[model samples]
Target: MTRRTFLRNVGLATVAHVVGCTKVIPELAALTANSVNSNTESKSGKNKLPKWKGFNIPDYFQPDPWYEIKHTPEEYFKWVADWGFDFIRMPVAYPTYLNISPKKQFISAEDVYKIDENKVEQIEKTIYLAQKYNLHVSLNLHRAPGYCVSTGYNEPYNLWNDKSAQDAFCHHWSFWAKRFKNISTGKISFDLVNEPCYRENINDTKSKTTAVPGTLYHNVAKAATEAIRKENRNFYVIAEANNGYAAPELADLNIGQSCRGYYPYEISHYKAPWVYPDPAYQPTPLWPGNMGGRYYDRAAMEEYYKPWLNLVKQGVGVHCGECGCWKQTPHDVFLAWFGDVLDILTGNGIGFALWELKGDFGMLNSNRSDVQYENWYGHKLDKKLLKLLQSK
Candidate 1:
């Protein structure tokens, strides 16, 4: 179907080319103008999600020639299924599946819809393997058309404010919804975006972060949800929480919600360079102890997650989309804190996905200095952390 027809069917309105900082076609000017009946208290009445526990397979996380290098091995899926886990979140960057001009780091606004079928086929292969191993695949756009939580190539426009960007974002999701229409919701889900926050400067990496306004977030998510459902009404959709911290504003959209487990950044990302930016300032993390001038324990954790739990009570499905500590944190402290994190989330019927499967924050090959690693098929495994996760 043509773009105009697709937008019309989904109730999105757009105009012709609007010249600005870059050549942008100001599409989707008002996502909710005539699209959805805005109702703050109305529930979509979608079924609640099962508490799915698994890890992130970071294969297409960035635009790299070796994009498939980090993909979870087929055996890893078997391990996850064997270990009683039922979910795997694959966070992807848009450029990974697009054929872009090598000279430019960012995709030109006009080229946002162009796709490379070969790259997409690889994505399909991974999903097929995950399903073969009985794992539910949650495909996520970690970096979307015009927004990314981390420092990457500056995008051509702002996803929150740019109509063109919103148009492209919704288009990509709609494309996926149609592509995976044959797959049952029991085996797959689409996480709309990752850690969306309102930044003072959309192009600046260090810009101060704040919660996205509820109306704007709702409009964007609702538009995407509508576009997806236009293709396949049965497809399960999930929206990540505001800034990945606050409760979601999407109960009316009939979709699942996802939140973060990196509550006290001091514990979860101790010396992670991206967060700390300086090694000297990284705090020595301790569980159930005072750090960064605040005391953190099980009580603090419970308080932190109370909002998420309350969202669940309101008939919204909630999950911890990302959690776990960087390798810099001591293993004992990491385990102690994460154990509480898992217990509170799982005990409350919310599930979690560790940030990665074989990386610094994962149970396998974490490369922590304090871990007594077990050699499992040439990969170092943190059995204690594995056992802790399984127990929850």
Candidate 2:
């Protein structure tokens, strides 16, 4: 059963409904009202407000309650509303927008992936779905068209350092901004670029936490933000730091805006398969100590994410745009870290979404044939953890 149906049957329908939508959620109403006021610029520069205070959003493939999709948008909306999420994070990759030959040769959409048209539509539908569920949506460029600084997906995660590639990347955002101008300042929030990187070279014997293709990220973010701002001024334009891993010690990054600055969610990449794998990935116990845990405990989270937290506190809204683990990690490890991340977020009155509801990330582990999926991994969703996430 869907979480909403499950909750209503248990007597929480009064809190589950959304206006114009069948769901009746006072929390959403209150939240919408709060968002309205929150978006308003405060008269006193000293007073704080929030940009966003909600979840990261479910994966594009899964919006909580699993189901077959005969109609993409309709099925998706039903799926999302069923789940108790206040927002949906729409992670977009750059290739979605393609321009043939900025060169002397003839240019045409033919050079791009055919997936573009339907992809944009799917994104449009997702925003509507979020509203249908009384949830806000963040349109994040997961792996930008070219410059993927981090090494998650198998894409040529390099061009991040190339100028031409970076320009193409910025133009990609411009393309999207134009394509979905309706979503601009409307339902979708813009995220500059995914986690960038500039680390101390290992061989050089100097490594840094929050380091990556420096100005490239900054310029692209500025470019992407400007592009979106030109089209939509009200919607949030989120900025990320190098290493999706939050670094309290980093000097140049500041995601949230409290006059003092803040880093909403600290880098919680410890042990994540994206960064680390099971013992198999790291043959020795001596794994690179660079990244290996969830947010540095709660206080550390507050301290590091606090400056950003103040942005949420200020109403610019802070969205933990991404966070999820693969099946390789131990369930205990997932729970301990996710639980900590969730607690720090809520206790501090921040909002977040699970990295994914389903997909290869193993939020649902479709392939039960695997040992890890059959065993401890599936249990990652402990009752306590599930209940806490559904709380927001």
Candidate 3:
């Protein structure tokens, strides 16, 4: 059975209905009215607003099962506000809302417009909660119709190479733009795509021209940005750097740009099953050691961030959308790396969101085996990391 069908069978329909009627309806109506005014004011002084300081709400729609968001929207938003975060980057998977299956791997542009209402409703509820808690929400398509950063889920054709894939991608984004056109640009924004990294074609470290055809990253991003602008001119659109946020070419698109802080992959992704340095090798990553022929340190991190910084100098807003060291890394090393990264991000006036808030790489209740887990709000809370994030 499909995930939607399963939810219905398990009485999620009833729960959603009750929640909508009791908590969501009134707030949603009020939010819509407030949004119109906010959007106009936000555009007037976009440059003056502080950078987004927040966390990513992972796994809600990136995977099929949707397990990461275990708490109610209210509880989650309250927790974020309580912790002093001002934004939430909510990543979603396109497959969760589409009917396409393994037997039918491709979806037409027509189907792309017919989004699952249930899924949209859940997202709206999240927006409502964000509005209630005064947190900005950045809706990110982590896994777009044609591409995903995660393995085992790539589309049959390259999103950049296939005409149909590009069209479908635009349609998907246009749907959201039209649906939430009334939402305030300050309260809600769109993150065009999660990680537009095509390592085989685009170099990760430098800015290159993506204006050429077949450059899926630039082509799709531009198309989606234009499409979204057509539906809602006031919305802030964010473009992620390619390949671990190492390339800032998309910054030329003249929208908000995002950079990641996962330099020295060995340290950031230590023992990560999906990445290099296999667990069996028992790889030990030192912070200032040589990797890929360059010595890495805080200065290296600052240099690595230069491209995005250049974009900022050109008057484009930049954000550190994803940055975190794994829990398996020594706690002290993790703190040192994170502190340096955070300093660099803040030092440049670039706002940042950690990789997460709860699970691995999270501030509260991370899955670090080395730290003693302390329960707070029904989850493990790493006081040290939490304190570090809050102080910054």
Candidate 4:
């Protein structure tokens, strides 16, 4: 469909354009205007803005090519700050930080694995950017190598079943705590794992229930967190359960005062072909009942997300760290969802980093250029959606 026709159906939406130092973020401006319906400061003076509405920057928009060499953090973050994002979520793969087989023969590896000198340097770079921009930065371990959202390695990672691997993971955390401990000027934090998925579904041959692995994964997180705190007294640390999304009822109450947990929901992944029928067709155009009203929206905050939001109010500081409906979920649905997300996050005390700055389903398309952002299957970013987060 032509971009004009698609947008006409939605009425007020536009892609964010970076025009040098300033950005023509028309999409966000529109979302702020329409998505939020309530008054910010009450005439009588009672309402307040909650903290969970913040956005993220991680593997999706790192300054350097994640798979290869180093890059400039200052130049990259300068662009990030231009986008009006309040925080940066940097997802670093631990293996990239260190070599696979540095000194020990613990695991059978034909090659070598040593920590890259540039990796931590880049981390320090991120810390500097965060401090300079007044942006909160959460350092997350995106790939633990042996475990992740899906099976990428041949070893059949069972982080719950393997005690040795778990210990190895803990040791890595200890090292990180010691090295980057000073990076935390209170704005920097350590996120335990990017998306700790521990399920038999990785095999496809095994029938898996969601409940089993999450429990074990949380226990492992608890252990790793304890190990980190042993060294750094007040540095902030975030732990995520097996699935990316969080459940207030399931959280371990013993989490440290300075530590919080995050949850990852596929508000952007609904009916998304990535999780649906054929992995080839990406769901777009905001089909009638497609995501219907889910649009990864704000209304969900009142009903579906209350459990998680309550935790943040209780001081858990729950973070979605990752959230965004398909760039083309459907205008009405997108507006509803985006508005709800803003209200709920701002209403409570949660902090969230959008799944990306730009990409397949990001706020911006890859190459940092402006193409129509999809609100549904084929729909592009509309002004209405962008305005949601910007709303008072």
Best by TM-score: 1
The C-alpha stretches of model 1 lying farther than 4 A from their native spots are 1-47, 63-69, 101-104
lDDT of 3 by residue, 4-119 (tens): 11000011000010000111111111123233212223332233235788888764544433233453447877888988889888877776666544233344545555577876
Over 1-392, each residue of candidate 1 has an lDDT whose tens digit, in order, gives 00000000111112222212222223323223222222233344321667899998878776432333445679999999998899999988887777765335656887677788987998999999999988999999988888866554568898877888888898898789889888777888899887776665666655555656677787788778777766656566889877545445677676778987876778887877655658797668888898878888999889988888877777677878888888888888888888888988888888899977887888888888888999998999899988988898
Q: Rank the candidates by lDDT, best first.
A: 1, 3, 4, 2
* lDDT value, residue 303 of candidate 1: 93
lDDT score of model 4? 0.46
Cα lDDT for residue 376, candidate 2? 29
The RMSD (Cα, Å) of candidate 4 is 14.0
Error of 1 at 240 (Å): 0.8
Q: What is the lDDT of residue 77 in candidate 3?
A: 75
* Per-residue C-alpha lDDT of model 2 across residues 23-79, encoded as one tens digit per residue: 111221112332322344452322222323333433332211122232234454444
Model 4: per-residue lDDT, tens digit, 261-372? 2111233343344244453454343322343334532333466566565555444545566666654354465555555565565555555666555454455442222334
Error of 4 at 324 (Å): 0.5
Query: In candidate 2, residue 102 scores what lDDT?
Result: 20
| Residue-level error in angstroms, candidate 1, position 282 | 3.3
Instruction: Report backbone clashes per prediction.
Output: 0, 37, 2, 47
